[model samples]
Target: MSPAAGFARTLRAEWTKFRTVRGWVLGTVVAALLVPLLAAVSAAGSHASCDRNGVETACPEPPLGPDGHAVRDKFFFVHRTLDGDGSITVRLTSMSGIITYPPPDHDEIVPGLVPWAKAGVIVKASMEPGSSYAAVMVTGEHGVRMQHDYTGDVAGRPGGAPRWLRLTRAGETLTGYESADGRQWAEVAVVRLPDLPAEVEIGMFAASPGDLTVKQADLGGLIEQMRFTETTAVFDQVKVEGAAPGAWRHTDVSPTPGTNPGEVHHPGSAVESGGTFTVVGNGDIAPVGTDGGMAVELTLTGVLFALVVVVVVAVLFVTAEYRRGLVRVTLAASPRRGRVLAAKALVIGGVVFAAGLAASAVAMPVGKHLLRGNGNHVLPVPALTEVRVIAGVAALLAVSAVLALALGTLFRRSAAAVVTALALILLPHVLATASVLPVELSLWLLRVTPAAAFAVQQSIPEYPQVLDFYVPQGGYYPLPPWAGLGVLCCYAAFALALAVVRLKRRDA
Candidate 1:
C-alpha cells in the first residue's frame, strides 16, 4: 500500500476502535454534556437583587464603551462645547487624593495618590459616559500619559504634577503634546476617533480609581475589596481655542445614580476661578471588565470536570490496548510503531476537540442568557472575541488529550498514566486558579506548567490603566492567550516524542 493509504487505514482503525467501546463513547458524551449542564446549575445557584427602602429593584447593566465592551467611564469634566476642531491646554499644578482603607491599616484614611490617579486635558465626544475621547494627562506615579477610547494608552514624558498637557483636535484626529516649559513641545501620540462628531466637548478632567486591598480568604483563594477614594486636581494656565462662548459645564459622570455628588465615594465637583480650575472626582475612565459581575467564562466552570473525563478517555484509549496485549498485535500488523501512536493521537485529539467545541458553543450563549436572567451582568465582548475564545477552548482540550494519550503510551498502565496526566495538567490548574498556595507561587505555576493553556478562556484583557486583582482566581492569566496555549503544546510535543522513541525500541 502507498504510505498515505497505509496511514489512513491506521487512522480509521484507531477511530473505529474508539467508537466501538461503549464506556469510552459514553464518557465522551458525558464530557460534552457536562459543560452546559453545570452552567445551568451555576446560573440557578446565583441570585441578585437590590432594594431601596424595601422596594425591589433590578440590577444595573454594566457600562459598555463605543467598541461594545465593558468600561468604567466616571470622572469629573469641566468642559465647554467646541464647535469644530480645537485645542485644550492646561498646566496641572497639583494632583492629590485621599485614600480610604488602604493597606497596612485598614481602618485609617490617609492622603495619597493611587498610581493611576490622573488629571488632564481631554477632547471628548460628549458628556455621555463611554464616549470616545483622548487626553494628555499627568498621573500620580506613572508619569504623563495620552489615553483614548478607554483602551489606548501611550506614555509621554516623565513628570507628575506641574505638567503642561495639550490636546489638539483636527477633524477626527486627536494629537497630544507635553512640555516642560510650554514653549518647547514634544508630541506624545496621534490617535483617530472614527465616530467623533463635528462638535465635541473639550475640557480638563480628574479621576481616581478605588484602592484595592486583597487578602487570602479563610478557605483558599483571595478576597478583594475596593475602598472608596477621591482625587483633586488644580489646573492653572488653562486655555481652550475654538470653544463656543458659553459657560463651562461641569458634569459628575458617576456610575451610581442618585449618588450624592459630594459623598465620600462619589465626591465629584468642578470649580473655576480666574482661569484656574479645580476638579475633584472619585472614579475611573478606562476599558473595564465585569468587576462587579461574573465573567462569561465562569459559566464554563464545568470544563474542569469535563477535562477530567477527557484525560481518562484519552489515557484508556491507549492503555487498554497494552493491558489486553492488543498493542503488540497492532504493532505486528503496523510494523511502523510511530504510525500507530500518531493514529491514536489524531483520533483522540479530534474527538475531544469536537466535543469541547460543541460544549463550549452551547454553554456560552445559554449561560450568558441564564446569567442575565439571574440579574447578573455578563460583560459584553465582540463577536470575534467570542469566536476566538470558543476555538481556543477546543484547541486546549485537543492538545491536552494528545498529551494524556502520549503519557498512556509511555507508561502502558491506565491508573499510572491518568494520575500523571492529571498531575501535569489539571492539578496545577486547580491549585493556581483556586490559589491554595501563595499568589506568587500560583502565578509561577501557570507561567511554567501545562495548566497555562487555560489562559485561552480569558475573554477580557488586563489593562494597565485599570487597577484590579489580576490573580489566576480573578480570571486573569499571567501569559497571553496564544502564548499560554503554546506551553501545553510544547509539553505534548515533548511527551509524544518520548513515547514514539520508547514504542519503537520496546517490545510492546
Candidate 2:
C-alpha cells in the first residue's frame, strides 16, 4: 500500500476511536453548549440607558459618519452658509480650557487643555451631526492638524496660539493652509470630498473632550475617571471670501444635553465684536470608542469557558489510550509511531475546530439578540470583520486542542497534562484580564502567553486620536489579532515536535 493511503487509514481509525467513546462525544457537546449559555448569562447582567430631560431612555445609537461608522459628533459651532467656491481664514490668538473635578486634587475645577482639545475653522456639509466636513485646527497639545470626515487627520506645524489657519473649497475639493504671520502660507493638506454640496456651513469652532485618568481600582480592574471640560478660542483677523462675508450664525449641536451620564448641558456660545470672535464649546468630534457600545466579542465571553472543556477533552483523547495500553496495539497495526501520533493530532484538532466554529456561529447572533434585549449597545463592525472574528475563534480552539493532545502524548497521564495545559492557557488569561496585576505586567503576560490567542475576539480598535482608557480588561490586547494567535501557534508546533521526539525515542 502507498504511504499516503496508509496514513489516511490511520487518520480514519483515530477519528473512529474518538467517536466510539461516549464520554468524549458528550464532552464535546457540553463544550459547544457553554458558548451560548454563558453568553446569555453575560448579556443578562449587562445594561445601559441615558438620562434625557430628567427621565431615563434607552441609550441612543452612536451617530454614523459619512462613512457609515459610529462617530462622536458633539461640538459647538459658529457658522454661516458659504455658497459655491469659497475660503475662510482666521488667526487664533489664544486657546484655553477648564477641567472640572480633576482627580487627586478633585477639590477644584482648574484651567487646562487635555491634549486633544480643538479650536478650528471648518466647512461642513450641513448643521447635522456626523455629516461630511473638513477643518484646519490648533489643538491643545498636538499642534496644528487638518481633519476631515471624523477619521482623516493630517498634521501641519507644531504650535498652539498665534497660528493662522485657512480652509478653502473649490468644487468637491477642500484644501487647508497654515501660517505663522498670516502672510506666507504652507499647504497643510488637501482632501477631495465625494459629492460635496455646493452650499455648505463655514465657520469657527471649539471643542474639548472630557479629561480622563486611569488608576488601579481597589476592588479590581482599572478605574477610569472622566471630568467635565470645555475649551475657548479667541480668533482675530477673520476673513471669508464668498457669500455675505461676516454673516455668521451660532448653533449648538445635538447630544449637547439630556443625553449620556455625567453630562450636564453647557451649550457653547459665540461672541462677535469688531470682527473678532470668541468661541466656547464642550464635547468632541472623533470616532466613538468602546464607551459608545459593547463590542460583538463581549457576547462571546463564553469562549473562554468553552476553552476549558476543549482542553480536558483533548488531553484525555491521547492519554486514555496509554492508560488502557491500547496505544501499543494501535502502533503495532500502523508500525509507524510518528504517523500514529500525527493521526491522533489531526483527528482531535479537526473535531474541536468544527465544534468551536459551530458554537461561535450560533453564539454570535443569539448573544447579540440577548445583549440588545438587555439594553446593551453592541458596536457594529464591517461584514468582513465579523466573519474574521467568527473564524478566528474557531481557529483558536482548534490550535489549543492540538497543543493539549501533544502534551497528553508526552506526559501519558491525563491529570498532569490537563493541569499543565490549563496553566499555559487559562492562567495567563485570568491574570491579565482580571486586573489582579499592574497594567505593564498584565500587558506582558498577554503578549507572551498562550492566552494571547484570545485577541481574536477584539472588535474595537484603539484609536490614537481619541483619548480613552485602553487596557486588557477593556478588551484591548497588546498584540494585533493574527499576530497574537501566531504566538500560540508557535507554542503548539514546538510542543508537537517534542511529542514526536518522545514517542520515537521512548516506550509507549
Candidate 3:
C-alpha cells in the first residue's frame, strides 16, 4: 500500500479503538462539560457585598469607567484661567493630612497623608477624567515628582529639599521646574499636550488618594475599598506671569463628592498678601487600579483544571492498549510502527481540539452572562481578542493532549505518563501563577517549560502607565500569547518525534 493509504488505515483503526474504550471517551466528555459548569458555579458566587445590589446601591456616582473600574478624575482644583501663554509658580511650604480606616470602628488616625498625596502646580486642559495635564508637586513621603496624563511620572529630588515649583506653558508644551531658591531652577519634566487650547487652567492644586484596603472573598474574589481623606496644602509665593487674567477662581473640583463640602480655602488674595496665597484642597487624579480590582474572567477560570482530565485521557489512550497487550495485535497488522504512532497522536489531538473548542464557545458568553447577572462588571475586550482566547484555548488542549500521548507511548505506563505530563506541563504554571517563587524565577520557569501554554488563555495585559500589581498572580502573563503556546508546541513535537523513533526500533 502507498504510505498515504497506510496512514489513513492506521488513523481509522486508531479512531475505532479510541471510541470502543468507554472510559477514555467518557473522560473526554466530562472534561468538556466540566469546564463550563465549573466556570458557571464560580461566577455565580463571585459578587462582592458592596456590589451585591449593584454599584449604584452603595456608590450612586462611583467614579467607574466603561469597564466598571474605579477611575481617577475627582480632585480639588484651585485653578486660575491662564489666557494665551503663561507660567504659574508656587512655593509649597507644607502638605499634611489625616487618614481614617473602615467605618463603625473607623477612628484610627494615621496622622500622615498617603504616599501619593499631591500638592503642586498644574496646567490642565479641563477637569475631565482623562484630560491632558501636567503637575510638579511634593508627595507626602515620596518627595517631588512631575506627573502628567494620569500615567507618566518623573521623579524629582528626594528628601523634600526643593519646595519651589514652576509650570510654564509655551503653546502646546508644558515645562516643570523645581528649585530650592527660585533663582537656580532645575528642570523636572517637559511634556507636550497635543492641541492644547490657547486658554487653560494654571494654578496650585492638592489631592489625596486616601487609604485603600483589599478584602479577600471566600470564593476567589477581591473587594477593594478606598477611604477618602481630607488633604491640606499651604501654597505661598503664587506668581502668575505672562498672562492677562482676572482674579483666581477658587473652584471646588474635588473628585470625591461630600469628602469636603466646604470650598477651597484661599487665605488671602495674591495681591493683598504680597503675591503669596495659602491654598487648601483635597482630591486626586491618578491611574485607577488595574490589578485584582477588576472582575475575574469567569470563562477561562476552569481551563487549567480541565487540563488534568485531558492529560489523563490522552495518556490512557496509548498506555491502556499497551497495558492490555492489545498493542501487539495492532502492531502485527500494521508493521509501520511510526505510522501507527502518528495516527494515534492525530486521532487524540483532533478529538480533544473539537471538545475544547465547543466547550470554550459555550463557556465565554455564558460565563459573561452569569457574571453580569451576579452584579459584576465584566471587563470588555475587542472581538478579535475574544476569538484569539477561544482559539488559543482549543489549540492549547489539543497540543497538550498530543504531548501526553507521546509521553504515554514512550513510557508505556499510564500513571507514569500522566504524572510526567502534569509535572512538565501544569506544575510550572501553578507555581509561577501562585507567586510561590520569585518573579524572575517564575518568569524563567514559564519561558522554558511546557506550562507556558497557559499564556495562550491570558486576556489581560500589563500596562506600564497603570499603577497596579502586574504579576502572574494578578493575571499578567510573562510571555505573549502566541509565543508561550509556541514553546509548548515545540516540546510536544520533540517528544512525539522521540516516541516515533522508539516505537520503530522496539518490539511491541
Candidate 4:
C-alpha cells in the first residue's frame, strides 16, 4: 500500500480502538461537571455571611482607651534605613514597632482588652528600661510569646551607634537586636509582647520617669534599620570570654509606670503568628477569569493522571496487536513504518485535543457558578493585558495534547510512555527552577518550558523578578501577554517537531 493509504487505514484503526474504551469519556465528564459546582457554591456562601440582614456591615471602627490617649493608631508603621536613592537599607539599627490600636486580648492585666475587656496596652521588652518593668495593664499574655536576640544584628553607624532597630519573629518569640557595625549584635531584653483575641498597641517604648531630669527617648529615633535575622539560631558563630559589658548590655528595661514616660516613636501593626493576611485596608483583590478577584485556581491534577490513561490506551492500541508478535504481522502489512507512526500520532492528538477543549469549556462555567455564591471573593483584579492571558491558557492545553501524542508514538508501551511524558512535562521546569539561572536566562527558559506555558494561566503575574515587569506597582511582564504565550507555543512546537524527526528515522 502507498504511505498515504497506509496512514489513512492506521488512523482509522486507532480511532476505532479509542472509541471501544470508556475511560476517556468518563474521566472527561467527571472533570467537566464537578469543578464548577464546588467552586461557585463555596464562593457565594462567604459573601452572605459578611452581610448583616439586607446591608453589608462595615468593619468595626477603631476604639479608644481611658488615659485620654487613643491607645494606638490602627495603622502600624515600620521604618528602616534608606540609601542615597531613598531605598530602604539592609544595614544595622533598623527598627519596627507594632502598634495595636486598643490593647489586644490577654489573660494578664484585668479590665484587659478582650472582646469584652477592651482597654490598655501590652508590651514585652527585650531591653530593661533605664529603670522600669513591663506588665499587663488592662490585657495580659495569652501565650503569644517571642524570641530574644533572634539572629542578625541591627545596622549601626561608624560611631558604634545603632544603624537601625531590628525586630525578629521566630516560632513564639519576637526579639529585638541592636548592632554597632551591622556585624556584632548586642542582646537587648526579651519579653512576650501581647497579641491575642483583643487588638492592642504592642511595640517598643522608652519611658524615663524621674526627678533629676526628664527625658523619654524616641525608640524610633534611635533606629537605623529593622531586620529579621535568624529564626532558629545554631549559635555556630558565637565566642564568649568573661564579663564584656561593652560587648552587650543586659538590663531589665521592661515598661514600668512612669512619672513622665517618653512618646512611642512608631507603634507597628499587630503581629499574628498564623493565618494569611494582606496589607490591611488595602484594596480588595479578586481572582482572575472571575469579575471578582477570585480566579478559582482549579489545578486539574487529573491532567497528570490523564497522561497515564493516554499512555495505557496507546499501548493497548499498539501492544494489543503486539500479542503473539502481532506487531510483526502488522508491520509486514504496512511496509512503510513512518506511515504507521504518523497515523497513531494523528489519532491520539485528535481525541485528546477534542476532549481537552470540551472539558475546559464545561468545567469553567460549572466552576464559575459554584464560586459565584462565595461572597468572600473580592472584586477581580483586571489588567488590560489579561485577555492575552486567557488565550494563553487555551493554547497551553493544545500543546499538552500534542506532546502526549508524541509520547504515545515514542514509547509504544502504555505505562512507559505515560511516565516518560509526565516526566518530560514536569521535571524540566522543576529542575530549571531549582538551579540558580541568571535573571535573563531564567526568564527565557521559563518562557520556553512547558511548565512556563501553564504560568500564563496565572491571572496575576506571580514572580516579580522573572515573570513581571513591576511587582510593587502591580506591573506585568514587559512582553505583551500574547507574546509570552507565543514563547510557550514555540517550545511545544519544537518538542513536537523533534518527536516527528525521531519517528521518521527510528524503527517502531
Off by over 4 Å in 4: 1-7, 22-292, 296-326, 378-395, 427-445, 460-508
Candidate 2 residue runs with Cα over 4 Å from true position: 243-246, 260-265
Write the candidate numbers in order of decreasing lDDT.
Answer: 1, 2, 3, 4
Tell me the tens digit of each residue's lDDT in model 1 across 408-470: 999999999999989999999999877688988989999999999999989889988888888
TM-score of each: 0.96, 0.95, 0.72, 0.42
Residues 305-382 of candidate 3: C-alpha lDDT, one tens digit per residue = 889999999999988888899999999989988888889999999999999999888888888888777666565555
- Candidate 1: lDDT of 199? 87
lDDT of 2 by residue, 261-304 (tens): 43455568899999899999888889877877888988788888
Best by TM-score: 1
Model 1 CA deviation exceeding 4 Å by range: 102-107, 258-266
Clash totals in order: 0, 0, 3, 85
For every candidate, C-alpha RMSD to the true structure in Å: 1.8, 1.9, 5.9, 19.2
Q: lDDT (0-100) at residue 344 of candidate 3? A: 90
Pairs clashing within candidate 3: 74-255, 75-255, 207-283
Worst 10 contiguous positions by lDDT, candidate 3 = 263-272
> Per the 3 Å backbone cut-off, how many clashing residue pairs does candidate 4 have?
85
| Residue 145, model 1: Cα distance from true site in angstroms | 0.7
Q: Count residue pairs with overlapping backbones in model 2.
A: 0
User: Cα deviation in Å at residue 288, candidate 3?
Assistant: 2.8
Score residue 35 of candidate 2 by CA lDDT.
92
